[model samples]
Target: MKTYQEKRHFDKTPEPPWRDDQDKGQHRFVVQKHQAAHLHYDFRLEIGGVLQSWAVPKGPPLKPGVRRLAIKVEDHPVDYIDFAGEIPQGEYGAGSVEIWDKGEFDLKRESTDIVEFSLRGKKLSGSYALIHTADKNWLFIRRKEV
Candidate 1:
């Protein structure tokens, strides 16, 4: 939470602030297309009380066997899952954000190196896997449809 707050000043940015009573026991997911220093997709999974985030450089692949680089980022507030706007210039992630896809996901498995899940979104659906490739680096792979 500190990392998230430290990156952006609440006064300058429109991003939501950290909330303690935001968790509703509902698992939600969001993929935000961010146009920042570089174009990337921000994938977030609602867990615990925050949103676990990843920055996929090339966006999520739709075809099976295709892998895209996903870099882990700071945990954002749960309220950020629905955020869509322009982050002011000079802010940490100064850019325009738009919701690309959003829905719920089911966790299938989780291990130290990999996490498998099923995403049910308007643009993305079916099983997916995130394999840890290096420290803070992961490979987002679309699993074969079953």
Candidate 2:
């Protein structure tokens, strides 16, 4: 979380501070609506030990066969899964944050680039794939039911 910590100052912001002893998450995921410089959805998955993050500019798709642009962001702490509040002014992501949808998900496959998963969330409940399109950019696609 070096990149995560470098962008934040724990003393001035309300964002979750990093504690190196955190648990490897239980396949949990979260989508946060962030009203920062722009309105975007922060999609995160608990992978490995940290929360791998992406900033979806147009939000995620609820309908199958739809694609949304997702830009890969820095890793967040495990505790950030439940984080929802305002980041103080001058902070890295200084804006109002709210949980859009959250629930457990099942990973079908993953690699350094692509990740295929099945989400069991309030607004999203089906198979989804995040395919790497290019540097720091990916396609968040809702897979059609078979």
- Most TM-score-accurate candidate: 2
Q: Write the per-residue lDDT of candidate 1 for residues 54-138, one digit (tens) a residue.
A: 9999999899989999999999999999999999999989999999999999988878788889999999998999999999999
Off by over 4 Å in 1: none
lDDT value, residue 125 of candidate 2: 92
> What lDDT score is found at residue 21 in candidate 1?
83
Badly placed stretches (over 4 Å) of model 2 are none
TM-score of 2: 0.98
lDDT for residue 137 in candidate 2, whole number 0-100: 96
10 residues in a row with least lDDT, candidate 1 = 19-28
Alpha-carbon local distance difference test for all models: 0.92, 0.95
| C-alpha TM-scores of all predictions | 0.96, 0.98
